[model samples]
Structure formats: structure tokens, C-alpha cells
Target chain A: MVTAVRAWPRPAGRAPAVLGILCTAVGAAFVASLAVGAFPIGIGRIVEILADMAVPGNASGSFDQDAAVLLSIRLPRAVLAVCTGAGLGMAGAVMQGLFRNPLADPAVIGVSSGAALGAAIAIVGVSLLPTAFRVAGGFLLPGAAFTSAVITTALVYRAGRQDGASGMHSMLLAGIAFNAIAFAGVGTLSFIASDEQLRNLSFWSLGSLGQASRDLVMTSSIAAAVGALLLWRLAPALNALALGAAEAAHLGVDVRGLERRAVLLVALVVGALVAATGVISFVGLVAPHIVRLACGPDHRIVLPGAALFGAALMLAADAVARTVAAPAELPVGVLTTAVGAPFFLGLLLRARRASGL
Target chain B: MRGVLLAACLTLAVTHASAAPPARVVSVGGAVTEMVYALGAGTALVGADSTSIHPSEAGRLPRVGYMRQLSAEGVLSLKPALVLATAEAGPPAVLEQIRGAGVRLERLHVRHSPEAVRENIRTIADALGRGTAGDALLQRFDADWRATRTRIAGLPTRPRVLFVMAHGGAPMVGGRDTAADAMLELAGAANAASGITGYKPLTAEAALAAAPDVILVTDQALEAGGIDALLQRPGLALTPAGRAKRVATMDAVLLLGFGPRLPQAVDELATKVRAW
Candidate 1:
């Protein structure tokens, strides 16, 4: 049935041009994010500062902390927003293509829940370790999150495989099962968590780019970039798999290998995102679906378009998060969902009408 | 010519802005607000965070919600000239944004001690241009501190006290370097949970292993199960505190704020511990 849909003719080249336009628009949103911030810095001042940063800062400082805030806080936050959005979007697009199911999100395969459980354990369980052994900072949370995502993905893939063929239905069901188990794990951590740990868990669960440090932003962005690019490169293979796994195998695609790679890539990208921003839901689901509807079901266009749109949407949401409260922030994760879900439902209705569903 | 004109305008604006220290202050952390009141400049405060629940009037001040969860717009609505916050008083981006809004953001270190309290009073007072008031508060606090030291020096035995943050089956117990730990140490009492540093949720068996002679809690914790029920809880029932009904409650702010009234708080707790 999925292959039947794949045989539906798509106008080539036109989609890529549309995708290029989308990227430029997303790039514009990224610049807009850089311009607006809680800081009293104007667009004029921001332009001067960004230019100044390149010119060795006029050799010695024009006000230190203000410059530090721009360099350290706002820049990284905007960058991370774009990178994390791209990562999640590409991962979602890849997952949907691999599963040949419009409903598949990067998290639907249990990787995100597993990542949350991993983070919960790091935040809560670290207290149990001797102080000397527990290393703190940017690495531990993401490391644990990524590790758990990989482990969970491997588990789901193994479970989904029967008679040397991976079943998308089985993979999704396995994801559901793993997600439940991960929830129980998180529950156990919460049960034993300290007041501080509980606070950490609560804020982290909401997720934000508010904690975007330069190093964290750089590392997460790189990981996300790599994951998105790898998945984007695998676009043709994903497109092949959409023709049903067995039929794709007959068409010279390595069905079993492609499944493993896709899941691994999703885990790496989405897990890094969850680690950084703490489970930003709906962007992955909504971004790619919007792209698919706009550009048709061509994997090549859907893949890159979703990534760009995701970045732009995340940046816009983050801007609202920063300024809506002025001196306080809404977690970007909450804003994305609150804003994205309605638009998504509307788009879904539109898609249903277009497809005569 | 255009560039030079822009520079002149920029410098003039920057100079004028820096010349005036803010008269309208927003205090973000509990301890920082307490110090502002202690410095006798409470009138300067237009707003404070939810954590600033000291001196009854502070509760009446417009709140910015929890210190960790400040709303940027809510805080900005008060139009504070200076926002005094602790190191932990943020979602960093919000604070950064607040700083960017041309507000003087004074973020003080939240050390858990009487010295930190004194320093906080002095710093905030200095900011408010009330150095004389800060000096007077410091001297009086010093005298009280010396008296407490003398009383604590004469103590024959330091009973082990465990500071449990909550009583209704909470796993968390306060350990070293916390305000509770400092209070016990200053009051001539040993913290039973010293083996583990910071607040942690040890297992019921592990918590009982600390073998506390008394359990210290804030009145806020009573909301969970009340003193009677808290005393009867599983791990708590095995402690010497449970056996003798030696659980003592104090105001959370008074116990942990580490503010201007800390020396008095220390004396009161020290006396209670001695009597126990």
C-alpha cells in the first residue's frame, strides 16, 4: 500500500527550488532571532556587536558583561534553537520515510522517552554516587541521554526484527512498550529524588534554550548537524524503503541495514536534542508533516524542507519565549507545542481534504 | 562625519545612563530581599520573587513568581532600576534579558553562612547608598555573633541533629554546607548527615543509619502530614527524635535565609539545642 503511493508521480527539481527558498526564509528567521532579545540592545547595536566580534573587538572592550551576554547567551541560544530544530526535523522526516507511515515521529520509536529516563537518572541518580565520582556539567546529561537513546533504539530494532525482516508495526509497538518502561524508570527516580533534583527534573522536563552556553551549543549543534546531514544523505535510501521494505530490497536497497542506520541516526539526533532542550515535542511531528504536505511526498524535498522549516519555527517560538515575559522566559519546548499543535491540526485537516481522506 | 556623530550620541546616552543608580529595586532571592529590609531601605523595593517571604510586608509586594521561574514581563512591569538577584536566581536567559533592558543586575553569591548574610546586607546597603546603615547593622550583628559564640563555646555536648526538608515521607535530608548545616554547627549541634554533603534523598535504612538525636524541620514541612504524622513515618519513627518527640520546627526563612537576623536566629536555635 505504501509502495502504491510511492508510484504517484512527483515533479522533480521544482521541489528542490522550493526547498532552497524555504532555507533562505529560515535563515532570515535565524537573523531575526539574533536581533530581538530581552537585553536592551537594539538591532543597530546588535549589528555593530556582531561586526565588532569579527574585528578583534576594537582590541579592548566596550563594556564587558554586555558583550559577554551577547557572545555567551543570545548568540548560542539562537544557534542552538536552529540546530536542534533542524536535527529533530530531519530525524522525524527520516523516521516517517523509513516507516512509510505519516504518523511516525522521532520519539515514536521510544528514543526520546529513553533519553528522558536517562536524564532523570543522571539528575536524580547522580546524588547516590560518591561525590568524587560524579562529574558535573554539560557532558553528563547529554552523554547519558544519547547512550540511553542508542540502547533503546537497538532494543526496538532487535525486537521489531523477525525472520531477518524488520516490521514497522512491530517497531512502533516495541517503541510504545519501551516508552512505558522508561516512564516507570523516570517515576522511580522522581520517587527517590531530592528537592533540588526534583526542581532540576521539573525545569529540564519543560526544556529550554535558556541554558545555552557556548560549549553546550557548539557540541549539540555539531552532533545535530552531523545527524541531520547523514539522514539527509540517506534520503534516496529512505525513499526506496517507502516502496515497502521487501520491494525496496528487490530494488537493490538493503532493507535491514537501512532500518538499523535510520534508527541509529534518529536516536543520535533526537537524543542530543532532548539532552540539550529536554524533550521538545511536536516540532519533529509538525515540521516534517507540513513539509510533506507543502512539497508532496518526495523524500528529497521533504527531508531538507522540514529541517529548514523546523529551524525557522523553533527560532520564532524561542523569540516569543524570550520576550513574552520580558525578564522571565517560557521554556521554548512549551511554546513550540502550544503554538505548533493548533497549526498542525489545521494542516492535518487541509491534508485530509487534499488527499480526499 | 556620520560615524563620529553616532559615536557622540552613543557616549552621551551611555554616560547619562551610568550616572544614575537605580532607586527602584526588584529583589529576586529570599536572602537578598531580607538583606534589603535589614539595611533599612525596604521602601526602595518595588517587587520581589515568591521566595522573598520574610518581613510580612514582603509578602504583600508584587511577586515575580519563584526565583528560578521568574517571568521577564512580570518583573519588567515593575520597572525596576536595579534587580538584585542571587547567583541561582534565573533561567539565565531571562536574567540576561533583564540585564539587557538597562537594569543594573546585581547577582550575589548565595553562600550559606552568617558571613554571607552580613556581606549581603553590606552589599545591598552599599548599592542603595546606605553605607552607614549597613555599618550599624554589621556591628550589631557582630556583637550578637560574639555572644552566640561564647554560649556555644560553653556547651558540654553537641547533639546530632538531622535537617529534613519535609516530613511527609520525603526522602530528602540536608547535609553539609547548607544553611541548616551552618545553623547546627554554629548552634553547637552536630549534623547527623555530615557523611553525605548537600541535600540528598537517602533510603529509609540509610537515613536511619545517621542516628539523629533530634530532627529539625521548617513549619512548611508540616503541611505534608503535620508533626504527629511526620513523627510516625517509617524511617523517622526509628530516630531518637521520634522516640522522645524531639522534632523542632522553625520558620523556613529564619532558619535558612542567612540574612540580617541570622545571629539572633543562631542564638535562639543554640538555646533550644542546649535545652534539648
Candidate 2:
């Protein structure tokens, strides 16, 4: 990121100012996210609904239809977008810092594919169980996803590690190999699903914020908050690792344990995010890249900055996704990819030029 | 006499109000859309989802996107009075929002059986206040259903049938408790993939073991490279049906819709099954 940004370097003493800008962007983006949707609710109504809901006694009754929509639909969706983006972005930042690989994204460990395959199996394979065990309800898919994430990470760790040490090259290759296998498994699972189940599965895999309920928002927020804390706590260690494992160990860092814990943290955040909203791409990857371009490669600044940037970017993309079709919605994942891919490419090109490659 | 005249005016007003616009109805599923049209309530439709592609007119209607992935504002853009959808309709949040907005959202139950289809006809008909049309549609449905059954009733043997569904990767055969299985039974054919409970990937050994006499596919599958591609599949080509080249195809929506046109689909299927 530094090499690429050499041509257009950020001014000195700009970090604080950039952070301030990102904070404001996320704040304004949050309000804008709530204000604009397929529904015609105005900013005034949204504010009023929130204000009313905030006051304990005023929650009585007759809040109006717009209030229900504002409070029930858009608000929760916006919160989820923020939470998911923050989690993914923070995860991506830490992953790049820890792995010391700029190209590494959130699911670089194959959690997304494993989680997806887990969901597919839950949807289709559960019905084949005996009548006593056949009643895997709404939680089944998400539960399966989380479980599969943990298992896949464990398996990848086992395969990539060699006699008390881990290899980044092997780990990445394992992610790729496991991802392919998981997708193939998903393909097999889709075949066994009833057409209705298939449609629902495909609909979910499309990754919409349309499933935003208050409970899901709250749950996702808590998980993301915990994940952010975990990632933030590891920033110094990550900074050490980014300089190379030998130097980090020389600096008194436990290199092997650090690698294991970092991977574990990535798995947890990726699991929660993927299980809740299906798989989202690039928020984690580009958020960090953009932050590195603005704030330099310090993990302490990079991690939190990426979190804010990712949350803001996700909400903005979600807003576009919500209104572009109006009365119809493109998947949030699709919108994010469209914007993230180009920006990411530009960053890569700049990086390549800076490196004189 | 003045009282009598006022009463008559009230009755006339009610009937005229109902007849004038028939209420702006929005349909979220293909079958519900078809049923609305079948009940002569097609003009009432202000918006429809992407799945509502029957009768050509539905195609011309403003689309609301996929049935399961709806947006309330897009659906409400038409300001519809009645929203007819299937049980499969919605991201659930959008449906709730539409209902919260005070539009009457009717989520008709979908069971993928003949009984459910009848209930669907009655429900859509009742929603549109077209009881007579609904009844007449039911009779045509009954006659067609009976005709299909009767024609194949005296057959010496029911051909073992398989429904192959593949968008990508390995193909799968439809098993029990599926629309394909139900459709096969309705057409008086035995489901070849009966040992399984639902759709699953078919192995070459499994395909060979099923020993299907006839293979049915959707028109979409057929269009995706025709029967040749299906027969050329590594696992399927060795099957008895593939070897004999006994493949038939139907429009995916109509074949699986289980809507007002289900009787037609069943008849079309039975005719193909009777051959060979």
C-alpha cells in the first residue's frame, strides 16, 4: 500500500484529520442510510420515530405506519450494515497485518465457503434425519455455519502447521483448496434440497439486509463489538509480526501463538458475519487497503480506521442498493463488490507502480 | 318510498364501486399471478414479481423482482389495495412492512400437492370476489385432472420416471416429498428416484440403479443444451432412459407452478409418459 501511494503520498499530520473525516462520514452515512430506502419515509419521520422510541413513556401506541417501517425495517438494517462492515473491516485489517500479506481478505482461511456449505447442508440434509432430529428450525443454518467455520479453521490450521510452526504459503493454499471443496459440497447439497428450499437457500446466498430484525441487529452488533475488541488488542503484536516473524520474536513476541490466536480471531469474526448476512466480500479487504493509503501501515491506526471506513462504505453501498431498483433490491454483496473491486484495482495498480514492479 | 330509493342507491353504489377498478392487486408468486388472470382479474394487477411470467400480459406488467426478495416500497409504488403472495413469498420483513402499510397482504399456503392447488384456486378467486369464475375454473381443473388420470388408468405398467435438475455441477434426481415426485405420481408414473427422500446428486451407479424408463426435464434444462447434453452426462448417459433416448420436457414454471394451469401441465405430462 505504501509503495503504491508513494506517487500520491498523504500529507504529514493528516492522520488525525483523516480519522475525523472518517468518523463524520460514518455518522452522516448512518443517518443517510436510515433516511433513504425503497420506502418514502423522510428524515424528519425517521428522527421522530427514533426520538419517540428513545423516550420510554412516549412509546404508547399509534406511532403511525411510517414509524413502524422506520423503526422496524430501515433502522435495524442500517445497524446491521454498520456492524457487519465494521466486523469484516476490522478482521481484514488484522488479517493483513498478522499475515503480513496485503492481499489477504477476511475469509482468507476459507471460513466463508465452509459456512456456506454448512448452511446448504443444514437446509437440505437436515430433513433426511430421523423424525426426532428433523426439526432444525431457523437457527439451524446459522448454527451449522458457525460450527463449520470453526471446524474448517481447525482443519486448515492442522494442515498448514508443520511440527510446532505454521507456514503462510501453505495456509493460503489450504484456504483455496478447502474453499473449492466446500463449494463442491454446497453443489451436492443444493441437489438434495427441495425446490422451495433451493430458492430460499439461493435467496439467502444472494446476501440481502432484508432479513434485518431487531434481534439479529442486536446480536450481530454484540458479536462485532467483541470481535473489534479482540482485533484491537492484538494490534501491537500484529505490528510486530508485520515486520517479519523473526524480528517479532526478536522483539519478544510469541510468533507461533500469535499466529494461532490471530487465525482464531479471524475465524470468529468471519463466522459471525458470514452466518448472519451470508458472505460479504471486499469490505474487509478494501477498507484496510484504503486506510493504509491514508494512515500508513501502523496496525494501531489502521485497524480502527478500517473499521470506520468499512462501516461507512457498507452503509453507502447499501443505500444505493436499496434505492437503485426502488421497490426491488439488488443483493448488498453485489453492490459492495461493484464499488470495492474497482477501487481495490486502482490501489493495486498504484502499489505496483510505487514498488517499480 | 324515499327510504326504499335510498336503500337501492346504496346497493347500486357498492356494486359499482367494486366493479369500477376491481382494486389494484399485486401478485408476488407465479401461481397467484396466474390464478388472478384465470379469474378474469388480470386487469386488477398493478404490479407483479419476476416469477409472474405467464399469459404474456404478466410479462408486460411492472415487475417487483424475485418473489422471495421483495421490497415494500417497490411493491407499494403501485399503491395496491390487495397483495396476493404464496407462502414462499418474501424476505418476511418486506411482507410485514407492506402489511403494516395497510395493504391487504394474503400469503396463500403452498403445499405442492393437488389439494393445495385447489385451495390456491379457491383462495385467489375468493380474494378477487370472483366466486363464479373460481368455481368454473375448478370444474375445468377437475375435468382435465380426471381425464389425465383416466387415460393412464388402464396402462399395463407405470413407467419409472426421474426428474433431473441441474443448474451447474453434478445433476440430481428428484426424490420423495418433492414437486417432481408428486407430479410423477399425478401423471400415473412411478418415481425412479424413490429410495431417497429429497433431491440429491445422482452418482453414475445411482443413476444406473434407478433404472428409469423415462426422464423428464424442464424446458429451461432442455434449452441449456438440449437432450444431447443430458444424455452425455457421465452419470446419466449410462441410465436406461438415456440409453433409449426417452426424454421429455415441459415449461418449468407451468410444470411446477401447481396453479390454475396445473391440469394442463399434468395432461401434457401424462401424454408424454404414455408414449413408449
Best prediction by TM-score: 2
Candidate 1 segments whose C-alpha is farther than 4 A from its true place? A1-21, A50-61, A64-71, A121-138, A151-163, A167-193, A350-357, B1-28, B41-50, B55-132, B145-250, B263-276
- Global lDDT of each candidate: 0.78, 0.80
Which digits, one per residue and each the tens of the lDDT, describe model 1 over residues A206-308? 8888765567678889999988888887777677777787777776776777777888888888887787788788889888888877777878788888999
What overall lDDT, based on C-alpha atoms, would model 2 receive against the true structure? Answer: 0.80
| Model 2 C-alpha lDDT per residue in residues B15-110, reported as the tens digit of each score | 646644336788988888988888877767778999888988899887888888888767876678789999888766578778877788788977
- Per-model TM-score of chain B: 0.88, 0.89
| Model 1, residue pairs in steric clash | A39-B100, A40-B100, A325-B72, A325-B73, A326-B72, A326-B73, A327-B72, A328-B71, A328-B72
Worst 10 residues of 2 chain B by lDDT: B4-13
TM-score of every candidate relative to the true structure: 0.73, 0.84
TM-score of 1: 0.73
Query: After aligning candidate 2 to the native by TM-score, how far in Å is the CA of A131 from where it should be?
Result: 8.5
Q: Report the CAPRI category for model 2.
A: acceptable
Judged by DockQ cut-offs, the docking class of candidate 1 is: incorrect
**Candidate 1 lDDT over residue span B1-276, tens digit each:** 446534643553454454333457899888888888887667667789888989887997776767887755457657677899987776665676667656788888788777777777777877766677789988999998898889779988989888888744544788876779988988889999998767777567765898888888888887767778777768888877778878887888888878788888888887765567
State the lDDT at A65 in candidate 1: 48
